[model samples]
Target: MSILAEEQIERFFNVLNQSSEIIQKSKDQSYLDSLIEVLDTVQSGDVQALNLAKADTTAVSDIYATFNRDDYDSEVLRKAIQMAVLKAIKVDKIQANYQITPDTIANVVGYLIAGIFNGHRQLSLLDPAMGTGNLLTAVANQLSNSIGVKLSVSGIENDDAMFELAASSFELQHIHAELFHEDTIQNVLAPMVDVALSDLPVGYYPIDANTKGYNTRSTTGHSYVHHLMIEFAMNHVNKGGFGFFLVPSQIFKTSEAKQLLKWMQGHVYLQGLLNLPTELFSNKASQKAIMILQNTGGGAKQAKQIMLGEFPSFKDQTAFQKFLTEIDDWQRNDLLQ
Candidate 1:
């Protein structure tokens, strides 16, 4: 990032922090709640945020004035909000699943999406497990930049705080996305989209009754939420459309893999599984891989050679570039054809 961009993000973060602190103190709300209110205040210039906080109008106005939405691009705004969200996560001791997806991972997902849908003039995207809207906005911003394509974005989030944060983030970024604040595993209605992306929440889904009819749902006990979400996401993807998920590196080795594989056999085509650099995680259990899948029909078929490999450490520029080149070659020679 350029020095100016870094300075701009810091400036915006400072404003967010100041406003959040004022609100948190007055309303006794959590940092995340206050931050959402601050973002809303900045986006709509509404006095409701001020009145709710019972904060002095002049002080709050001065803090918010330092931020000019026009001054920063969507990516910059995203990064600034990401920084603030990270702080709020720490302050609130949010759960592991609520953590924001890293920028590096989001960038990789964007690259894969661009490659899959290259030359398309327009696209629709869905994120069934969107948290804070960071990954969704990041990928959308990248697609707009890389392909100059018009985009329709949609996301689903069950958490109240995350839903509000995502809604505010999208509005602030000028991204007109359809957002659903409901449990994805439930009967949430959404349009079939051209592409879907998710950093799947890892754990067991508590509701056993909702597991009925899902091919990947376990016969006993709670079903793996990640597996259920993958099925749910793929169901909403238009035939031949792609879905990219950040899944546990050992996803296929899990006990539930048999059911997941069974579902894959009848529905989507597994196109690729690219393991992110191990160095990115603290241990093997925590590592994630990007799994690419394509819905059946619409002429979609399995590639002659599946794209599979471990990315080199990001610090190793030469190896990383070579891996990306290999991905490009695979897409051109096998997948796209």
Candidate 2:
């Protein structure tokens, strides 16, 4: 019932295009601010839209000013606002620190989450580096499409621009989420969940030498920043919860990373690994892998052999569709049995 018709979707894009034309003529204001202001006005349904329109600061008013509100579809406008933020981030007008996941990869991740927990009526999902909320948003959308309600999402993002964009987008889409705008490692997260998903940031954050979880060998010798983020996320999972992380492939080859992996194996079930394409990200040239883990609750019998696979170029629609089908079949058989 919440799905939009094809015509409505087209109209939304048309509205976005017309709004862009208007913003292009206004030199003093930015599309981001105007779009955000319009979204705020739509969600709040107050006089801010008119106030921004009346202010003689630019050639045009706020994005909602020109629209005839009597017949305007608020849903379309909300979606346009959400898409505009993602578009801005995509064009590099916003600094994402080159951490955003590709749309296709995000879809694959979403599909895996949906399939793995197909029978679950409620889920809690977390993303440690949730840039613009795309990955979680994608998974939420997938789940809603399958079961007609969104998941409970808690995410952490250190970047201010990304945090605002993600928060606004989640609000616009009516997705249930609690987002933390701080460094994930420095911040304490106590909520346990059914799923954890992240595309970890590639750099290091300064750690206190005396901190408990700190390992000087891993931190100084080889930048185990991803390791720390993974551990933090892992701690916030329920007994049978699962985690999926997009990490550098070095975790499988380096000695420090091997130590981290061994430690994780002792605590949780190391389910499998999916090696992603080297060219999946446009901004960074690094080989990436998807590490899949399940919380074993420290049971000795819970450890199992890990299944390994490689994802074909996710950009190829046919291959992705096939991969999704295979995952669905596997999840159905494995999970049901």
Candidate 3:
């Protein structure tokens, strides 16, 4: 069924029951105004523009209320969206797959979400993290209406969540999800956390001071693992390719994060940094950084970072658009140009 069909209606209702924004859109006229902008963009004779209007604004509002529930925070919802899309695929068609994975989804969304903000094109292929893909499913749901080709996908998620979810999602829809059950974290502890420990490991918010590092520390399991995400993105991406990776925010200022960021800044073109607010994982949101890196050029002289404020009404996408419009042009011109 189409994402905009009965399933979507049921999903929206599901959100209405759980999300804070269920009844807030009416009260938030600016958000409604953003919807008007989206409608205007869609009616401007560009199908992709319309898709962008929906994807960036309207669809997001719905997703925020539904898929982005507290239980489905960033990482989990990232997984759930992947799982939902996997369930959306056809079983037999799994044989003819795009090989998308959780990592791939993380990478691609990281890139696209940020890239779309900068108004970029020409990013055609993606190499998903190579294992059964919960992340890829999220990407599929995220890009359901976009007219772009999934050239190739490589993914890895060492647990059954990867395989079981990927397989089921594939059977539900026609989308191809190339999945694997390999441990994508290299140079790190194998299966670092307990399978049951899927929630946001407390104290992940980006604070100037140390909050409370639950499962985090400067260990192999801590920082080196993300290096793999960076190395993979820096290496596997086709020249001039852009990749989005769900890397930790510490990589921006922390000494450990520096290794990867330094390599990224020196080797690949450094785009903007989206400093997502805290507790995104508080319920359905997780405070995570979406690293939009590119292999198009050899890093930036200085990375441009943007701090995003709070948007309690995730359904009110107009606030986000307002935020985007509010983003200083001088700050964005570095990469957006």
Candidate 4:
């Protein structure tokens, strides 16, 4: 089933690639009219006659030629249609600044975190930096597949394009998800979550006067927004909640980050820090680490120790699988003297 689904998705992408030229050439109104017709047909459940937007005769023929491939399963086609809507936002020039989490890593993170829950059927999960909702989808997929129950998923995305794409993707997956289009630092949500996950953007954000009081670490100083986002995710986790953040490993080496890391240790039980492969991202300079934060909440309690693990590379499937299998045991280890 999975193989057939993958093939169909590949073929659908081919059609989109072929239609790229026509879409770029068509007049604005003509493109809109053509798109409306295609949408209307599909919404009416007419899959057999799925057609590309009415462009030039040559463009239409090119799309049909690409679509008429070796058909193995009709099931894949329906899934492809829904995915097409989300994949349409991949205009590289427009979205170059965005760093999308790869599907494999996202799923791995989601599955590992979901595995931590023993009997929790109803879960509240949050992703403050959810881009196109990939992280949310991955985590939710793992949770639902494991416990046979839907999750109350919430996400915040500041990018307008990402916000719309994520909303459509959630609808297609039939996930009961709430997404917001607001800066995470500015507008805070009211609900606390059981789990929080984010692949935060790498940059420094100037602390605005109004939002300067959000974190106690610094009032008016410029801080790594990535660190602030991680703090934001940690703060939103309910007492005893779990959070997973993908950040640069340099957070452990820098003087400023050491203070924040010390502060984090004082608050949450730092479960694990696994160094990801440097080449995992398009930006090879990004040395990433996955910090698993288990919020014990405030008061006199302090974490006994934090588990530290390093992976030279994630490309080794066998070694990576072994790493994942031992996570539960890794979390139970006492690193404090």
Candidate 5:
């Protein structure tokens, strides 16, 4: 980030914190909830927060006034919101799945998606598990700025706090997205999108009845939610549309791999699986890889040589650039062909 961007983010973030704290204390709500109210106040330029809390209207207005949305670009505003959400997560002690997708991973996803769909004048995207709209907005901003593609974005979040946070963040960034607050597995009414992306939440899905028609549903136990989510996400993708998922590195080595493999056959072409840098995780088991898939139709076929490899540490600038160059070559020579 440039010095100006950094200054903008810090300034905006301080205003968010101050306003959220006032709301939290007055309303007896969690920081996350109060933060959402503050965000809504900033976006609407109305102190609807005054209705929810006993905060002094003048004090709240003064803090909200300091955030002039025009001063920061979408990316800078997003990072500032991300910092506030991270702090809220810490204060609220939310579950692991609520964690924001790191910027490094979001940027990589954006790079891959932009490369794959570069020539399109427009695109539609879906995130089956948008935690707080961070990843979706990051990719949207990249596509718009890099290639000037008009985008239609949609996301689903089951948790109330997350759903509201995403809604607020999307509005604040002026990212027009269709958002649903329903369980993705049970709700399959999503629009058929051109590309589907997710940092798949890890765990076993508890509702077996809803898993009745899913190919990844377990035979003897609750199915892995991540497995079911991938299947669910792909089902909403247009023919030959692509999916980019951040999944556990050992995704295919587990007991549920057979069911997942069965689903992959004839349904989608497994195009690539690139292990993220291991240093990004705290342990081997927590490491993840980006899995690329293309629905099997509209001229989509397996790549001549699947793009597979481990990314060098991002700190190794030369090696990282070489890896990206190789990806560009593969896109031209294999996938696009």
Candidate 6:
């Protein structure tokens, strides 16, 4: 079920838009006040709110039930939509867990939009481990506001509860999905997706019986519950398609993600890396990384290495400029060709 009734929300949008064209702040606040009234009605868990609002139950059925009415606000709604859109982008690594804090969602969403808007082809999105759909929502809002977010998205998640929540979130927003209740890596067809993988086995044995051992690690067997979340970003993303994803932060900093990085390098140009804030994760291991990749059709030298750096720790759209400056500085240095 949608958190806010769609008709009610649409009216708010209509009013909000009308107010935007005028200079009167009170005019906008009038519409905003109406929106707040609706938010108040829809925020409560009481069936009365659902019934009275007469919301589309189909869309409202997911996380709305879990929403603490007291928490209902513009920030809450913005966060929910932000998370939903970003988790649906197409990439080869990581899945956004809805368990992620609202602050993290806000920060990532801002950075994602900032870092990925330089190209002209638009973007294709994916989120393999969509929880309550924070990432996808964020991506959608950013793209709609950005100059180049014209791509579709896909996703997959094995957790039934999470899958249901994600599906509901997407439907409410009039967004389509190809989400599946399956392992992310096992299935490859997607606008985008990720599979959780576990148990890496490394061997020093010779290749077959003909070559010397090359010290390789392989995930030939993926446990049903433990598979690498390989984000396959393919929303018709052309050769230079770009992706910004929040996977297990260790995928870039630890031995676990090291090989995956090497594997990833063979497929896409690794752009910048942003060390994520430790406070954002639910897990004790707060260290994480944001990866940027671009697929270059094989006509020139594959990128050997891309820039890696820190992003600002802010939630406003204004922070985007800080990132652009960093990227600009990197490019002016001829760091990326």
Model 4, position 85, has a per-residue lDDT of 40
All candidates' lDDT scores? 0.91, 0.65, 0.40, 0.64, 0.91, 0.45
Model 5: per-residue Cα lDDT at residue 115? 96
lDDT of 1: 0.91
Candidate 4 stretches greater than 4 Å from native: 11-22, 27-91, 216-221, 281-285, 297-305, 332-337
lDDT of 4 by residue, 40-125 (tens): 33223342343335545445464555454245233344345334443443433334444456666676687667666646768888
For each candidate, give its TM-score against the true structure.
0.97, 0.78, 0.49, 0.76, 0.97, 0.55
Model 4: worst 10 consecutive residues (lDDT sum): 35-44
lDDT of 5 by residue, 193-240 (tens): 999999999989999999999989999989999999999999999999
Clashing pairs in 2: none
Worst 10 residues of 5 by lDDT: 48-57
Task: In angstroms, give how far residue 21 of model 2 lies from its true place.
Answer: 7.8
Instruction: Tell me the TM-score of model 6.
Output: 0.55
lDDT of 3 by residue, 173-256 (tens): 334534446543332222211000010111222331321222232433333444544554355555544556554555565566
Q: Enumerate clash totals for all models, in the order shown.
A: 0, 0, 44, 0, 0, 49
- The list of candidate 5 runs beyond 4 A from truth reads 52-55
Query: Residue 36 deviation, candidate 3, in Å?
Result: 41
lDDT for model 3 comes to: 0.40
Residue 45's lDDT in candidate 4 = 35
Candidate 2 local distance difference test against the native: 0.65
